[model samples]
Each structure stands twice: as structure tokens, then as C-alpha cells.
Target: MPFTVLTILAALLVAAFLGYTMLRGRRSDEPTAAYDLRVYREQLAGVDRDLARGVIGQADAERVRTEISRRILAADTQMRGEKAQSGPSSVTSAVAVIAVALVLIGGAWLMYHRIGAAGFPDMPLSERLELAEELRVNRPSQAAAEEQTTPVQPPKLEESYAQLLQKLRDTVAQRPDDLQGHILLAQHETNAGNFKAGYEAQRRVIELSGSEASAEAYSNLAEMMILAAGGYVSPEAEEALRQALERSPDLGPARYYWGQMLAQTGRPDIAYRVWLDTLRSAPAGAPWADAIRSQMDDLAFRAGVFNPPQLPVASPGPTQEDMEAASELTAEERQDMIRGMVNQLSDRLATEGGSPEEWARLIAALGVLGDKERAIGIRDEALSVFAGNDNALQMIAAAAQQAGIAQ
Candidate 1:
């Protein structure tokens, strides 16, 4: 109401000022013929007084009177000419003023109509802030509700595997206290890419473990939830991650997911720092290490850390052919093959002192196998070997850091 009043008052003030200016402009400045004639008469009277006082001769008085009359005539003629010109000029000036006023007023109204909430009530800052807080409080619940309503599409499975899954479900239902069974079911479901089922199974695992549940269990459940949501870091998943991080600060999966939450919430700097720190301590070849490495540069850029040195492209791990060849082997034999490969890489780096990239690869492989101690040792040796080569040393250090090997 105050704003409306002020706006109306402003419009009235402008109009009043413009109208006064127009009226004042219409008045002529030149004197009329009658005023000039009066002035001439006063001068003639002064000359008469001079004659009476014997101050001037009659001839001089006549000459002065003649000059005064001449000036009066010229003034009258000039005033008539000015009057003749004033009419058209005054009309032109008034038209220009009216046009300008119309344009200004019309333009203001048009612009306001187009872009402003002309009739909306003014909201106080406190009220606006309160409304924002309300939205913030409700948003997570709304997202969770939406998630619940959305259907989970499970991956297609062979008939035999499907029957087995059904049997497992029935057995679990029958034996609700079987925590180990739930864990196995969760792992197998996740391995088969049935994330929804895996998520539910993992949730049960946490429930069964109770206060004894490890951070890994919470992190595993969170991972399944995230996968089920197709990578969405839903509020529920975020809570699970928080629980995991609280129990184990150095848990790589929790840190990675937390970093993702930070990024999502528009804190790229914090996210970058978290991911960078996590990568530094992560075991080489760890899945979390690769995930962080893949996104580190972009996150760093967003965090204003520009032109960071590029990390070496990760070497391919076990190929499909390798996996297929090992498929026929027993579980123990498969483990032996992987361990042998890791040892061979380790031995080669220690004996041959390979390129910085090769050293980095080996360190990452060790990290992936959860051998942080060995990874750290390899990093120190690589650093010593590449002491004179700053670029190579940096690459080796970065690879080791990403693998979560201690500096």
C-alpha cells in the first residue's frame, strides 16, 4: 500500500512539474509597446525638469526626446515580431514536452507490465526466509516419497536362478534370524545386478547385525540403495552413508559417496578436498579409487584448482578372456592366479625398476588387493628411482595417492 501510494505521488509530482514548465515557457519575455511608451514618457518628463532647472538648452532637450521616441518605436516593432513568432514555437515546445511525458509514462508501465509482478503483495524478508526453511525441511521427504512410488525394475534372470532366488527368499522368510544367509543373499543378488533385492537384503543384514554391524555393512547397504536408484544419492542412501562414515572415517566407499553428496549440494570445493584426500589414502586399483580418479579433474576445476596435471590413464585390469580362462578353475585356483599376477608385477617393479607409469600401475593393483603396506613401499622406491625426474616422480606419487597408499 505504501509503495502504491508513493508511486502515485511520484507520478503526480512529475506531471505537476512538467505542466508548470509548459505554462511558464508559453509566457513571452519581450516587453509590450504600451510599457515602452510609458518608459519614453518618463524620459520626456525628466528632460522637461532639466529645462525648468535650466540644466539643458531647449534644442538638446528636443534631440533627447527624439531619440527616446525612436527607441520606443523600435521596441514596439520588436515586440510585435516576437509575438508573431511565439505562437508556432510555443505549440512545438508544448507538443515535444507532451510527447516526452507520454513516452516516459507509457514505457514505464509497459516495462513493468512485462516483467514485474505488478499486483503481487510484497513479502517481508522474514516471511520469505521462513518459507524457504519450510521447503528445505519438506524436500527430502518429498524425494523419498517419490522414490517409493517409483517401481524397481529387476534384471532378467535364468529360470533356474530365479527359482533359486525364490527359494532363498522363502528360506530367509522362514528363518528370519539367519544373518549369514541374509548376507550371502545380498551379495549374490548384488552380483546378479538385482540392486533392489540386494538393497533389501543388505538392510536386513544391518538389522541382524544390530549394534555389531560394521561400517562396511552400512556402506554396502548404501551402495545397493544407490545402485537401485540408478546412481541417485537419495536422502535414505545419504543417511546410510553418514552412519558408515561416522563409524569409519577412512572407509573409502563412504568417503566417495559423501564426496558425491557434497558435490550434489553445491559444495564442490569441499567435495574436491574430500575426494582428493580419499584418493591419496585409497588402495591402488580399488573401485573407489577409479571412481574418484575419473571425476577428480572436473571437480578440481569446479573448485578453482585449474590446470591440474593429468593423471596417467589407468591400465586395464582383468580382461574378459582372462576371466573366461579362469572360470573353469576352482575358487582357490582363481585366487591363486590373481595373487600370482600381483606378485609378478610386484617382483618386476622391485627388480627391473620399470617406468613411472608401470610403477604406478603396480601400486594401484596392490591397493586394489588391499595391500596398502606394499603399495606404500612401492611408491617410496619409485620416488627414489625417479628422483631426478620431477614429472615421473609426480606421476608415481599421484598414482600411489589414488591407490590410497600412504605418502
Candidate 2:
């Protein structure tokens, strides 16, 4: 505010100074005809003196007088014309000078008010950085952020699946130290919008993991915490992301979250750099890469990149013909080949139980084949088989969701 006042004052002073100078110059102007007439009189007197002193002949003296007399008559006529033409013009000229001064002062104020920072002092680069750091350190805490956040709606689930979810929670509670139990609980609870419970279960998973924990485990815990806090990165999430990055710096999900945490802490410069590096190494159709791609333009602009480079594209995946060549049974026909692989896998799983992933994959493939009833039956069986293994159950649940049998 003070700066604005000072600016207006300075502009006013300059405008006033210019206007006064112009008006004063105009007022001090003497009539040009009067000056010219005086000079002619002096020449006539000089010619008389020269003639009396015999400095020139009488004819030369008369010729000089004639020229002087002509000039005097012209000057006298101009003076009378000026007196007639010079009345209200002086006042009009003064008014014009004042209007110009007013316009200059008002224009300066208008331009400054339009775009200038009126209250804040000038910010140097170092001061701006310091301000960003201050904002980082003093930002809202996780609980506070959550208090103000509007929660995202959880994925809808059928009542039967909800009952099963409750049973799984009960099962996890009965087996407090079961690593798989907590993993499953965490996944379901988050899906159910019970993020508080989800993050708690996730924390237990991390605790149980101990030294053998992979970077993915830490990242999962961070992701759960971020969701619970409505996307705010609290101190806990920061520590988790740090651990994940330290263990596996190239991990896609971990790097994505790391970039998010950095941006939340007022460091989009570092965040953009981290996200770009992560994108370069991301595999085709990576979910993390998609997340980065959606927000890349805004992040780049915040990081001072006006014309950000184009993002990396995914390479083409294998075609149906390529699949037929790789899997020999596929040569006869595509549909027949798919059924053959599914039947073979089914026969193997029926005799010798497969891993949770294999069971989930089978369930999805069955859904793709449009045998939803069969997919549901298989899903229920898998659920029963992995009742004690929550992590396995969670995987199966996802496949079941894809099958459209349950949410």
C-alpha cells in the first residue's frame, strides 16, 4: 500500500513539473514583431551616423535607409496583427497543459493498479525460495488436512461380499500376527472406504515384514496412509516414501509417490524432475505413468517449464498372430486355442492347486470368455480355499470384481 502511494506521488510530481515548465515558457514569450522592429530602428540610426562621418556616400546611405524603412514598416504591421490574434489562446494553451498532466498521472496509476503487486515488497529469487521453504515447513498437518478434506466414495460392494469382508476382518483379528491376514484386511478395508482401518492393517503388515520387507511393502503402506489422509502426505507417509525410494529408487509406484510428497512440500522443481525420470524407465501401461501423464503439464508449468517435452509413448504390445506363433496350440484357431489353454490350466488347478495369482488370472480369463456363472463359482471356491490367507483372498476378490460377479 505504501509503495502504491509513493508511486502515485512520484508520478504526480513529475507531471506537475512538466506542466509548470510548459505554462511558464508560454507566458514568458515576448512578441517577435516588437523585437524585429527594435533591430530595424538600430540599423537606421547606424546608417545616419555612417553618412555624417563620411564612412559611405550619400547614395549608399539612402539605399541602407530604404531597406531599414521597409523592414520597420513590415514589423509594425505584424505587431498590430498579433495583438488582434492573441486573445484567448494563452488560456487555452494552459488548459491543454493541465489536461496532459492529469492524463499522465492518471494513466500511470491505472497501469500500476492493473498488474503491479501493490502491498508486497519486491521479491528477489533467494527471497522467493525462502518463502517456499517457509510454506513447506508451516503447511497443515495430516489430521488437520483430513479434517478439511471431502472423502472420495469407496468402491460399491454387494451385501454378500460385504458379509465376507466382515468375516475376513474378524478372521484377521483372531490371527493378529498373521501377515497375509493383515495384507488382505488392508486391501478390503481401503476398498470399503474404511481407510482408518485400512491404514492400521497396512502398518501391521509393514511391522510384520521387518528386515525382509521389499520396497513395495513400504510403498503400499504409504499409499494406504495417503488415501486415509485424503491425499495429504504426513510425516509418516514421507518416511515411508523415503524408505521405498532408498530401497528401490527405480520403482514406479514409489517414485510416483515420492514426486507427490515433494510437490506437497512446496518443491515442484524437484518433483517434476523425479516424475520425468520415473516416466523414462516406466514399462508399457504402467498405472503410475498414467497418473504422471495426466498431471505432467501442470507440474511442468509449476516447475517453470512453459513448453514441456512430449511424454514417452508405450511400445506396441504383442499381436494375436504373435501370440499364435508363441503358443503352438494357438496355430489352429484363436478361440479354440484360448479354450485349450483355459482347460489345461483348469485341469492342473483342479488336481494341483495353483498360486493365488494363477487362480485370479483364471477367474479373469473365464470372465473374458463370457462364462460369468462359471467365474463366480470358481471365485467362491477360491475364496473358501484362501479364507485364512487375506492377501490371497484380496487378489481373488479383484479378479471376481473384473468378472462382474461382485464389486
Q: Give the per-residue lDDT digits (tens) of candidate 2, residues 1-407.
A: 47777887888788778877776765546566999999999999999999999999999998999999999999999988876765446678778777977888789878887887756787778987888778767777667877788877778889998999999989998999999999999988988988878888988998998988889888988888888788888777778888988898898898898899888777899999999988887776678889999999999988998988786565434445558676765444766667677776777788888789989988998998888988888898899889999899999999988878875
As for candidate 1, its clashing pairs are 281-404, 282-403, 282-404, 283-367, 283-403, 284-364, 284-367, 284-368, 284-403, 285-364
| Whole-model lDDT, model 2 | 0.83
| Top-scoring candidate (TM-score) | 2
**TM-score per candidate:** 0.47, 0.55
Model 2 poorest ten-residue lDDT run: 312-321
Candidate 1 residue spans exceeding 4 A from truth? 1-138, 141-153, 309-339, 342-353, 356-407
| Cα shift from native, residue 264, model 1 (Å) | 1.0
TM-score of 1: 0.47
